[model samples]
Target chain A: MRGMPVFALGCALALLLAVSAFSDEPARAAGFAWETDYAVALQRAKDEGKPIFLEFR
Target chain B: MRITDLTVVDIGLFDFDADVTLYCFVLNADEQVYLRYGGRDDTSPDAYLNEKSLHAALEKGLDLHGKWKAGELKLPARPAAKKPADYPSVKSEVIDRKQCVHCHHTGSGKTKLAASKGTLDKLKDLWVYPDAANLGLELDADTGITVAKVKGVAKEAGFKAKDEIVKVTGNAVYTWGDLQQRLHEVPHDATSLKFTVRRKGAETELEVTLPEWWRATRIERRSFVHAAEPFPEFWGRELTEDERRKYGVKPGEFGAEVTKFWVKTNAQSAGVQVGDIIYEVDGTRSAPYTGHPALWVRLNRKTGDTIKVKVLRGDKNLEFSFKLRAKAW
Candidate 1:
């Protein structure tokens, strides 16, 4: 139906908004980032060729 | 909904990591599970029987309380409770985000959690960005990001510094402090540092040189600056067991926990009770905490060795005064 394109566009916009909302930096400027078993993700990001935005939750 | 897919985010190092110990646990939207904190060196049977490994599907995890049961995970001896919490309050559990439509539904035993394990509750506060290279920044450690100051302002690649820039000039920046902040907000063709830095007494305009841009697949963690004027605001949403299933936020791994209280291994009667979460060390609004229990009873760092811990023990955030090494029973 013609509604498919409109629906897809809506979904795309929602996804974009979701990604942006989650892309915040936890102003850890003065403190230290908690270290953990994050080495694997670091390695994977390397493999996938993506810019790993390291954020501390 | 069926809280699904728990996994590990990443393992990272921070500035205080030089001698400090700090860790975090992250889970998706749903799946509230139980986590027991044990050490790698605790040679007692308590470590094993206490459910040391990651236990996903914690809805099924509680059943493993006694006798070494299913999977790689072992259950710890259940402690005698004042009252059996069959329907435990789930009070201390951390919720970062909510569940979505794709999540499956279930009933008690099979009853699905109210949320999904796909998303992060406080997505703004949690996550680990994958790394681009083994060592993302390939600069000489001693000299740092290797700056080669240039003349004109090349294309300032905001914080999105992935690929190397052609119109390059200075060194590679490790921290997003002043120099990088200026380059980001000012203009791409920046000739000098035109930003003010708040130091001890006054705001000074320091000149920071930008080196040629080097691009690599570096990993950045998704972290939020939780205004912890007092750090208690940053607890709760630690890595849960279900989360361990997906992002590998390893369960029972002793990533990071509140320092209840540290009784010197030798201090028979230091008059300090357990259950105190440290708030401050010496006077500097407590820094990233190392996993040592009796840490406050020791020296702080290279300079301020003596430490005094300010912690919250339930109703009161008491102040415990103790000096490192030079302590008496």
Candidate 2:
């Protein structure tokens, strides 16, 4: 009915909000953090005196 | 120390086989590549992937990092930085369209531009990221370069299963990517390769002879430029093991039966009939190790090249020569 349409729209908006929350965040696991910006990662590597693990997909 | 995840980036200096779903580079802040970590054959995208191999590569990366810090490691000067924005083809294809510059765009755009300019070496261009199996060695995925199986040339050269590969021509290799990177440097006309392997805790050096078309790989999966390759105009079905043994087909020879020919092709006109067992082409007996012979024809032969195909039909050996034609796009 009329209420069902509004309910579906509410659900769609909720889903969009849910996706946006995690979309920009890079993945991290087991104390290893992933950075999306290569320049920033390179800067961090130089500061920390370490090598980079660059993965391309 | 950081795991940098790249998406929608210009893969100019880091160019690899774009067909690969995942690839890794262990490098320093100065962009000096310490090691590469991912590669695959035509079997599957993750065919050579192993967590243990990555761990091994990372450990070696740390060692290189230490050496670099101590000023003991000497790496070649970094290549000049080039971005997709600098390439005309990429600029027009991706940048002009407001699309994200994909890793594959670099390869596809450059190849398309090369083809248009009539400068693309079809054979050499198609054979990218040659598989290690071409050397007749199948390294165990879990243990880096530990040889799990050996056949053909490596077997003939005394390579055995469980032999742990330590170096390629004296350069230490710690992972499949490292080994493949060395194989990538092999010249097309090079006759042999030297391998230093640790077997039963003893280092042994062996030489593997390179065969004709050894650099050839399965190109059908390489979407960037395979369509530009001239097709062979004939479909061939690989002869089953039983059929090959029954026909007394020798090892290191292409054993396939021509199933059909495209209509009006020079192959059909040259008297290459269906059901003919094609064993050789242009004096070459087989494709690269584990590759189909029909693909060999496509990768090695070009349009206007006169090809001599040898076949077997009902206990009779026959030969046919045809002018290769450009495949219709």
Candidate 3:
């Protein structure tokens, strides 16, 4: 049976590459994409007087 | 890329943070993701905190499977003060499920940066553009419309900057702030007609007369839970869409914009309308629900529950049903 439709088309192309590799973290967090080395990154925020920290992921 | 455990918050700065904040938890059930720190051995005041072995590995849960470096981040051991009144606080982390689709903020969410102290700041997942940069606006996604930035501002308010205008006359013309307040009440007028324009994509209509501060009372002095998380990391608790389009306000139905209101702390006698486009929050119709980190994970919600909303009010589609405003837990 043609190897059962080529083994069901290789298991539907590995289930579409396992749903696109778990959506690379929700498609790089749906456009919030960040990766700053800014060449050594570290500007450490100061859009007018620093002292900011409220991180949660 | 090995020891699964991360939830480090040592924060304690004045300026060298340049904008410093980095918290990225994407735990996908597998194993290994370590990098929690906060030391100076401290006797209090600032040795930092949140490093009790990553709170015993977030109470034994976060595991993501592979690739987790999460290095170079500081500030821990401050402790002592305590009492920011936990808004979006109180977490053990395990949201079994939540679906908002877009406008169900009736539960009124946003705000989660535990660790009681003083000036805490965040600007994580940013993007909000009015003058430029939504990458250049193409978006439509079922009428969240950007239709090429409103047809490039309707070829220019109806036909190329036509001399930065000296002619868009009478009753000060229909919305876009009544043609920017009838061009600032005839900032030296150029014509005198009145067809009451509104042709972004061709659909003629007219009825202009805007004053009374365009229905004033658009307050600000925020912080009733301001959610909008997820990004590459720098310092988290989210806010980057270029930092919510640089302090948020990207509404458009005719432009000449500026309208934002995400208040709480007992919402001072209700009167909200800043680009009005919420669409069912308590009554449940909700529309274009994509931004705001998918609307701050539906704010833990409590209180009477019933926020049916749907405000666009320009092409007319007004509906509201308020009654569910809790979430400061």
- Listed per candidate, the RMSD to the true structure in angstroms reads 23.6, 9.6, 22.0
Candidate 1's displacement at residue B27, Å, is 40
- For DockQ, the strongest prediction is 2
Tell me each candidate's i-RMS in Å: 18.2, 13.8, 18.5
Q: What's the TM for model 1?
A: 0.22
How does candidate 3 score on lDDT?
0.24
lDDT by residue for model 2 over B1-329, one digit each (tens)?
22222233445457566666667777788888887777777677766675456556667777888898899988866666666666576788678887776666666666667777888877676567777788788889876599999999999999999999888888777778778778877776779999999999999999999877677675655666545556676778878788888877776678788887656777788898999988888888864444356777766777778888888998999999888777733
As a whole number from 0 to 100, the lDDT of residue A40 in candidate 1 is 48
Instruction: Give the poorly placed runs of model 2, Cα more than 4 Å off.
Output: A1-33, B1-12, B85-88, B200-203, B227-329
Q: Is the docking of candidate 3 incorrect, acceptable, medium or high quality?
A: incorrect
What lDDT does candidate 1 reach at residue B317?
56
Off by over 4 Å in 1: A1-57, B1-162, B165-263, B266-269, B272-274, B286-306, B326-329
Best by lDDT: 2
What fraction of the real A-B contacts shows up in model 2?
0.54
